[model samples]
Target: MEIFTTVWKDWTMYQKSSLLLMGICIFIILISCIYIITRNRRLIIHAIASILCSAIFTVGTMVILHVVFDERISYIYMLIPLVVFLVDIISLSMNLGYYTSTRNKKSFSPISVKKELLRDSLQLSIFIILLFSAISVFMGGALFTFVIAMGATALLIPWTNYLLLYWIYR
Candidate 1:
């Protein structure tokens, strides 16, 4: 209880505002996703992807904040909703495009989609991790910055996979 109080007192305006902003964006995205899903029952896969990605983001944020206990954690949190929404929108658009392009096809096989998603996600995650590592080492050159960059990159993997899966199958 005392520790919680101290932590709360130490919290800055940035952290509070970041949390509020994240919550608002998440609410909007959630509503939009639900609307899209309801309109097109075929997009059930999207609902699953969004839910899984959201869970991963939420858990990663909580764990990182707990481990670091730093004010700068809010900086990472602030970017979460923006990244999630951007990926969501892009993937949704791609899914729509794919659907229209293949309207004549009876159905997309889940097995092929899964294989492609896994391979693409692994490739993308590796690229992202390496890119962040290089940027942190070359630009920041600080252990702290490296750790933060790596953490952010780690948090991004699930969302990337979500994006790929949605794009691949809709």
Candidate 2:
């Protein structure tokens, strides 16, 4: 019980910049997911670029946290980003698989492709949200910071969708 308390206390002490970076990462993931669902080639490219940038930022933030704050790394702290990375990889793999599977099929419908993409997006979103919730539960650092993190995680979905649609149609 005491150990749990200590760990929670430590987790809550995240720096403001670290929290902001994490939020940006989540935003990137959400945008990628939205683009995947839409199947817009141009938008997908932009989202991928954003994802790469965010990944770089996230790694830099992690390094700063480790060196400057002297914080010990833990799997719990990395869970959400790892899951987001996995989801991106999985989505790419699925796209390749779909292309290969349909190579010989003459009657491939755009509707089917859209459906599958939507399904994948929904699954990724659910997993991301669950990961965020789990992380929040074990977070012991700063309560206000945690709340900001939670807000960012929660807002990512709708904000990404809205921005993607607005940009794509504009």
Candidate 3:
């Protein structure tokens, strides 16, 4: 689209690399989440948490960046990735809670290596997000909007999986 082309022209190589990394990270995180969500049809908390956290993270990050840094990127550009990164973190947090809950133990399948796997996955995802934020800060906030775009991507991927599949099929 014209908008994407214009935005693409405006970003630097570092900013673009950051965006690509963020996109890859979001895709991996969302894929894992979609798998879990499909497997555990009884629980919808992960999906809900991802949505709420996406909104909160987007607004919070935007306000904080505005106050702490002096970058002038479009709101749309910044919003795309912030939502993505936040949703993954949120989804992982909910997953951690669910896996550790008493309810999990009561299920027919006892707690096993799956819990460990989930915990590790969540930790890795969180670490990546922290890395993105830290690196963006060190880069003088120029790529901060791309980082936000990553978060936004994280938010959309899981929820739109069905829509994506439908589009592909149609």
Candidate 4:
């Protein structure tokens, strides 16, 4: 209990620069994951570009929040980009699954709309969880607690994708 309290105090003392550095590291890791998943050169280039754009947008928003609104840099700010990255991952997974199942052919089936809607809803749910996690973290929740919440939220992506694929096949 004493050790945990010490760790929490250290975490609370982390500076804005440290948070920014961590965010940059996560962005790099995300781009690397994209490259590994999609080996096509053009796709890798596009994915890196997209990730860079997202990083810029997030940093810009944080700057505005800090300067204009006087918001402090915290774990909550990190959640914004994390959620955005998760949504992108879910969307990419769904698109890849759809294309693989359809063999790159145009879908003329009536169920396509349903599949798309499900994918969209899954993305929305991810966003909502992101919002919730951010709020919880900002409220001085334990780091492990917020991590558990994120992990639980992440489970939905695979489950939603699996169910969607099963329905599409059936």
Which is the leading candidate under lDDT? 1
lDDT of 2 at 23: 67
TM-score of 4: 0.42
lDDT of 3 by residue, 110-167 (tens): 2332444345455555765676667667554556566754644453444443232223
State the lDDT of candidate 1 residue by residue for 123-152, as single tens digits.
Answer: 555665676666666564234553554447
Q: Check candidate 1 and list the clashing pairs.
A: none
If the candidates were sorted by their TM-score against the true structure, best first, what order would they fall in? 1, 4, 2, 3
Residue pairs with clashing backbones, model 4: none
Task: Report the Cα lDDT for candidate 4.
Answer: 0.54
lDDT of 2 by residue, 1-170 (tens): 33345556776566546866876777677666756565557546645654564355445544555566655545545544554445455554454355446645886655444455556656766766676666667666654233334334333433343343345435
Worst 10 residues of 4 by lDDT: 141-150
Per-candidate Cα lDDT values, in order, are 0.55, 0.52, 0.51, 0.54
- How close is every model to the real structure, measured as TM-score? 0.52, 0.41, 0.38, 0.42
Superposed model 4: Cα runs more than 4 Å off = 1-42, 104-170
Best by TM-score: 1
